[model samples]
Target: MPGRMERMRAERRASGEASFFYREVAFNADAVKVMPGEYFVHSEDLVITTTLGSCIAACLWDRQAAVGGINHFMLPGDGASDDGGRYGSCAMELLINALIKRGATRRTLEAKVFGGAALIAGNGALNVGQRNTSFVLDYLRTEEIPLVSQDVLGPYPRKVCFFPKTGRAMVRRLPPAQREAAIALDQDARRRASASAAGSIDLF
Candidate 1:
């Protein structure tokens, strides 16, 4: 018989939702990192991890089915271009669909939202964190998914670890060094988005 980790990886592979998997030394367990524009779902005893600055990481779980998934999104909505999980609209839908496909029902779904830190120092108009935060909150309300818990809208980046099968989530505010790294990551994402926009000429 296959072990839990093996079964988990097999399921992930079958569903084409595999991310970066590794043995997490700190937790001494099988783990996968869900980066920006990425999400993962599983029904095994595995940990899903992600680091967030301005981006939002939403963990949706169905207790009855014991299935859950997490998504990391940088922007509020999907624009003219289809950028996969980078946009909240696409990310949320992808995660919910995957969970339902894994036997989770929308009626029993609950959410824990994290990140959305205002790490960037500038005008309020440029705060993507606030925008992302608002989008996810409104989405959950509109979908009628119960928001069980949340830690959002602060000045610090966060590292989130989520256990899917048990619906347990742990969050740690990153220290100074890690905070700088997170800010750098967010800045790079912004630059990429700007460049992508600049290269495209939209038709009116």
Candidate 2:
């Protein structure tokens, strides 16, 4: 028998299937990993997913243009990898660039950011959630992209759905334990990326 929290999480995951625009965007690891330094874009529709631990996602919308995009990244990429700038710097740029491509600019854009949850129970040394949140806020400030809303930094994982057409972002909090598991998965991904990079450098 599952506990109350477990049952609740199961319920939420099940409910997600009922959404009309529930598109499963894959990340890293397995066939479903959104790497630490990547971005994805889509038009005005509900983009929904679950996240835990230290990973963070940002959602951008342009009201006048009825266009928007979302990005899920781990660390703030330093522009060294093939990803160009997949982390926060790249993530922000990707979303903005997509919007610009669609006729939206910083002067006309509205943004809403989510995730960056600290789901673990212990005083973990890897507070990627906090770091991610800080990086995003700083980036937005530096770029002058005007953030209209945000839901970040908590003890719970989150389910975020953003409607680009309407510029509305919906967020639901996940249980604490569930968030911890998500964090564990995130750490494992970092380990894998590190090992892969080490192997590549040796080959060079």
Candidate 3:
């Protein structure tokens, strides 16, 4: 028989959530994996995790309300299309809106950004990592959200884990052996973005 955690995760999956929920044995707590083009918000003791190469993951928290969320985006902006959380513009809006819906206030929101590495060398035009980092910083500035911390703009991929309710985050720089997989994933996402014509994103 499935255990309590397994059953709960199964239910979440049935509801069409973008990410999969599970238990992180290291933290001994419930966790969710936020993949590229996805975001998750919660007010419970849940850890949200994601791996990135040239992509970015922004963790937003409203300490006053004890609510927070995180998003993983592959590109800087949609330019005019709404590719869900695949673009930074839509990802930021979605994460903020979701947090507000969970009782968080914009005025008290704080941000911690991660990822955005120049994993692909010798390709200035394809260096989406720098662009993504710039976009997220500008977006936060324009929205007046305080940026508490950030780990970005390097040559290494990262694995990030964020605790929503407590607003805690951890980032690990992956070794060269893992960089190939991360780079491949980001490249594929970029290709899909280029091929797809999405809609415009709505702001909250």
What are the lDDT scores of the predictions, listed in order?
A: 0.84, 0.60, 0.83
lDDT of 3 at 170: 96
For candidate 1, which ten residues in a row score worst on lDDT?
Answer: 195-204
Model 3 residue pairs with clashes: 82-199
* Per-residue alpha-carbon lDDT of candidate 2 for residues 11-44, written as tens digits (9 for 90 to 100): 5321101212223453211112133444444453
Write model 3 residue lDDT over 23-122, tens digit each, in one string: 7988898888888888888888778898888889999999999998888888887644546777789888888888888899999999999988998776
For residues 88-179, write the lDDT of model 1, one tens digit per residue. 88889989999999999999999999999989676376688888899999999999999999999889999999999999999999998887
Q: Identify the leading candidate in terms of lDDT.
A: 1
The root-mean-square deviation over C-alpha atoms between each candidate and the true structure, in angstroms, is 3.7, 10.4, 4.6
- List candidate 3 stretches off by more than 4 Å: 1-17, 79-82, 197-204
Count of steric clashes across candidates, in order = 0, 6, 1
Cα deviation in Å at residue 194, candidate 3?
A: 2.2
lDDT for 50 (candidate 1): 92
- Give the TM-scores of the predictions, in the order they appear: 0.88, 0.70, 0.88
Global local distance difference test of model 3: 0.83
